[model samples]
Target: MKTEDEWQHCLTPEQYDILRKKGTEAPFTGKLLHNKEKGKYICAACGMELFSSEAKFDSGTGWPSFFDANKENIATKRDLNHGMIRTEVLCKHCSSHLGHVFEDGPNPTGLRYCINSASLDFRK
Candidate 1:
């Protein structure tokens, strides 16, 4: 496991904020929001595969949305911050905050893993 200082050293300010501090990036401003390539989305902090392009879709929520995820690489927790209850997604390998998941999504899984682009790194 990486120490807080080490993690801060390794990640950029935005990445550290979103992944380690559970901060959300601005809507419609994520770099991966419009990505439509075939690849894997891995955790920025730990490099664990999180989502695939096949499960990605435009949810129009301004974040990168996925119908499915590499379940083995993720974990969820109940978030009650800001007077709202939500499920918070994390990278299982490192426990880094990825984003949140919602029930409102397309068919098949009906789950939208609304993730932060700063919390991820793409690979083809």
Candidate 2:
């Protein structure tokens, strides 16, 4: 495990807040929110493959929406913050906060991975 100083040294403030402190970016304000590219979305903290371009879709939620995830790449836990029940998604390798997952999504998987762009890196 990395020390807080080490994580702070390598990660940006936004990334640290979102990934470590479980903060969220504003809706429709992410850099990759409208990205229609072909590549893999990797974890910013550990470079673990998280999502594929093919599974990405427009949820119109103003975040990076993916209907599916890479094999065993993420970990989820029940979150009861803000008087709402939600699943908090995290990087399986680094335990960094990636985003949340909801069941109201498109077919095949019916999952919406509303991810923060700062938590991911694209590799084309």
Candidate 3:
């Protein structure tokens, strides 16, 4: 397992800011937003598999959006940040903030899991 300092060194300033500090990346700037590989998305913090490629889709919302996670692999907390209320999702084990969940999704769960690419590590 990587220590806090190790994670700080492994990620860039912008990546650390968003992934570690619960900040958001600039829209349409993430490389993985357009990725269509068959793989798994793991938490950058502790290497926990969160989302699969099958659940990923083009939401045209700049950031990568997923319909679901890997079978309860993520945990969520109600966020009241920025004077607004939203559900913030995190890695189940590490408690690393991934992003927020919205009710605007395609089907089934009706959840648009808007996540920052910096918070995830793709394994192909």
Name the runs in model 1 displaced over 4 angstroms: none
Q: Which ranges in model 2 have alpha carbons more than 4 Å from their true place?
A: none
Model 2, residue 8: C-alpha shift (Å) = 0.6
The residue pairs in collision within model 3 are: none
RMSD of each: 0.5, 0.8, 1.6
Model 3, global lDDT: 0.88
**lDDT of candidate 1?**
0.96
lDDT (Cα, tens digit) per residue for candidate 1, span 1-124: 9999999999999999999999999999999999999999999998999999999999999999999999999999999999999999999999999999999989999999999999999999
Candidate order by decreasing TM-score? 1, 2, 3
Query: Model 3: runs farther than 4 Å from truth?
Result: 1-6
lDDT of 3 at 124: 100
User: Which candidate number has the best lDDT?
Assistant: 1
Backbone clash pairs in model 2 (N, Cα, C under 3 Å; residues 3+ apart or in different chains), count: 0
Any idea what lDDT model 2 has?
0.92
Q: How well is each residue in 1-124 modelled by candidate 3, as lDDT tens digits?
A: 5577876898888777887788998889887999999999998877889999999989999999999888578998999999999999988887778989999998888999999988888999
Worst 10 contiguous positions by lDDT, candidate 3: 1-10
Clashing pairs in 2: none
Better of 1 and 3 by TM-score: 1
